[model samples]
Target: MKISARSVAATLRDPGAWRIVLLHGEDAGLIRERATQAAQVITPDLDDPFRVAILGRDAHDRMVEECTALSLVGGRRVVWVREGRDGLTGLVKECLATRTDTLLIIEAPGLESRSKLRALLEKAKDCAVIACYPEEGRALEASIRQMLSEQGVQIDPDALSWFAERASPDRAATRAEVEKLFLFAGQGGRLTHEDVQACIGDAASVSLEDAAFAAMVGDRTGADLAIERAMNTDRMNPIGAARALLSHIHRLRRVRLAMDAGQGRAEAMSALWPQVFFKRTEAFGRAVAIWSADALMQAAVWTQQLELACKQTGSPDIVLCKRHVARLAAQARIMARQR
Candidate 1:
C-alpha cells in the first residue's frame, strides 16, 4: 500500500505484514538509504552472506532464485534489488503473491509517480511504496534539528537558520555536512552561526539565491557574477539555476496573492511554508510591495518556460538560462522605474 508521509519512518523501521517494499524518488541518496533501512529490519548486518542478497539491475534469474530460496541462516531473507526499473514489476508482483519469507526491497530512484512498478506497489495490498523525496523548508530544518539533538549537540536559532539555508537539497550531501558538523561540535557542544560557517560553509547555494535576487532587483552586473558562480559548480547546474529564478517568482507570487486577498504584510509572510530565508525577508518585503499579482504571475510563466527550454535534448542550458535571467532583469528595471 502507499505509505503516507507521516508513517514512512515507522513503516520502514518495521514493514509488518508487507511482503515487498518499494522506495522510489528523485533523490537517489534518500532512496538508497531508505532501502538499506528496510533491509536492516530483516538482517542486522546488510552484508550477511546467507540472509541478505544484493543484486544488480535486471538480474531476472538471480532475483527469482533468491526470492524463492530459503535462507541458510535460519531467518527471513532480504533481497535488495538496486537500480530497479519497470522490467521488475511482473517479478515483484509474482513474489508478492507467493508466501515467501523474504522481504523484497527495491530501489528505484528515478521512478515517476505514474511508473508502472511504483503504481503497482502503491496499490497492492501486500506491498509498501515509500516516496523518498528530499525534505525542504521547515521539514528539512526539523530534520537537521532532530539529527543534531540525537547527537547531543545544540544549535542556536541563528545558526540553524543559516545552515539550513545553505544545506544541500540531496540527502547524502546534507548528511555528510551534518556529520562534519557533529564532529566539529563534539558531544554536548553548542553550534553558533560562526561555528557552523567555519565547519560547513557552502557558498554555491548562497550564490544561487543571490543570483535570483539580483535578477529580480535589476542588478545586471551582480546577477551576471552571481549566476556564473552559482552554475557549473560541483553543487549546482544549469537546470538548478533556472529553478532558482522560478522559485523566486513563485514565492513572490504567493505573497502578492495573499496581499491582494487583503492580508497585512506580516500575515501574508506567515503563510510561507518553508518561511522566507530570515536574512532575505526584508528584501522580499520590498519586492512584494513593488510587484503586482499579475506581473508576478507573468514572471512565473516566463521562468517556467525558461526551465522547460533548458530541459530539451542538447540544449545550451547555461546560455539560455543567462539570457532568460537578463530578460527578467530588464523587466525588473522597467517595473521599478514605473513604481
Candidate 2:
C-alpha cells in the first residue's frame, strides 16, 4: 500500500499489518525521521541496542540474512537500511515476499511513478511505501503553523512568512528551524517577526541567497563573508559548496540576460526558477539592477575557475574557499563601481 509521510501516525497505529516499510524521499533528513519513527513502533525500546540493526547499501546480503533469522533476544527486531539504493532492491523484494516477524525499514532516494522499488512495495500485499516530498508554499506554511501550535506558541502572520522565507527547501530543516524558534520563544510565548529575525540566524536559505546576491551586486566583502560562514558554520562539504556557488552564478547570469531582453523583475525571477523564498525575488530584482549581462557572464567564468581551484589545488579547503570568495567579492565591488 502507498502512503504519504503525513499519514505516518495513522499507519503506525496499526503496525501489525505492515511487515515491510519503504520510506523514500529526496530529503535525507525527513526520510530518516520517518524511518526512525516507524522503527520505534516495531522496536519500542530502540535504546536496547541489540533490537535495532542499522545497515547501509553495501550490506545487502547480510541484511537479508539477518532479517530472515529469528531474533535470539526475542523482542521485535527492526532492520533499518540507510541509503539502500545501489543494489539492495532485489533482496528487499525477496524479504517482503516471505513474511517474517521482523520489520524491514528501507530508506532510499526519491522514486518516480515507474520506479521498480516503489512499484514492488506498492503492489505487495504486506508492504507499505511512504513518499515524503519537500513541503512548499501553503503546505509548508501550514506545517510550520501546526508545529508551533503543538508547542503552545502562537506566531504572527509576518513571522510565519519570515520563517518560511528563511527555512531550507526541505521539511526536516524547516522543522528544525521552527523548533529553534520555539525554544527561542520560551515554549509558550507568542513569536513575532522581530523574534524570528533575532533568533532564526541566516539559515541555509539566506546564506545561499546572500552569497548569490553579493556575487551579482559585486559586493565582494558580503559574498566572501557569506561563503566563509556557510563553509565554517554550516559545515557545508567543499565540493557541495563549490557546486552551489557555481549554480547560483549561472542562475544570476540567466536572470541578467532575461532582464536585458526587457523582462520585468518578476519575469526575470521566474526565468531563474528560484526555490520558495521571498528573498529569491528580491535577489532577482537586485541582480537585475546591479549586474549587466556582460558582468553576469564574467561571474560564470569565475565560478568555473573557483571550482577547478578547489578540486585540483592541494591547499586546505578552508583557505582555498576563502581565497575564491574574496576574489569574487572584489570582482563584484569593481563591477558595481564601473556601473
In terms of lDDT, which candidate is strongest? 1
Query: lDDT value for candidate 1?
Result: 0.83
Task: Tell me the tens digit of each residue's lDDT in model 2 across 1-339.
Answer: 888657776886666578888888787777887787788877777766678888876676688777877777887788888776635668876786665788888888666566777787888777888777777766777878998999999998767876775478776777888788889887678988778878875554456556766766667777777766676656465666667777777776676777678887677665443242454466556656666777767766776766677787584766766676677667766666776
- The predictions' CA RMSDs to the true structure, in order, are 4.7, 6.3
List the global CA lDDT of all models. 0.83, 0.72
Q: In TM-score terms, which candidate is top?
A: 1
State the weakest 10-residue window (summed lDDT) of model 1: 57-66
Per-residue alpha-carbon lDDT of candidate 1 for residues 259-314, written as tens digits (9 for 90 to 100): 88999998899788656767778878877877888988898888788889889999
Report the error of model 1 at residue 124, Å: 5.3
Candidate 1, pairs of clashing residues: 1-127
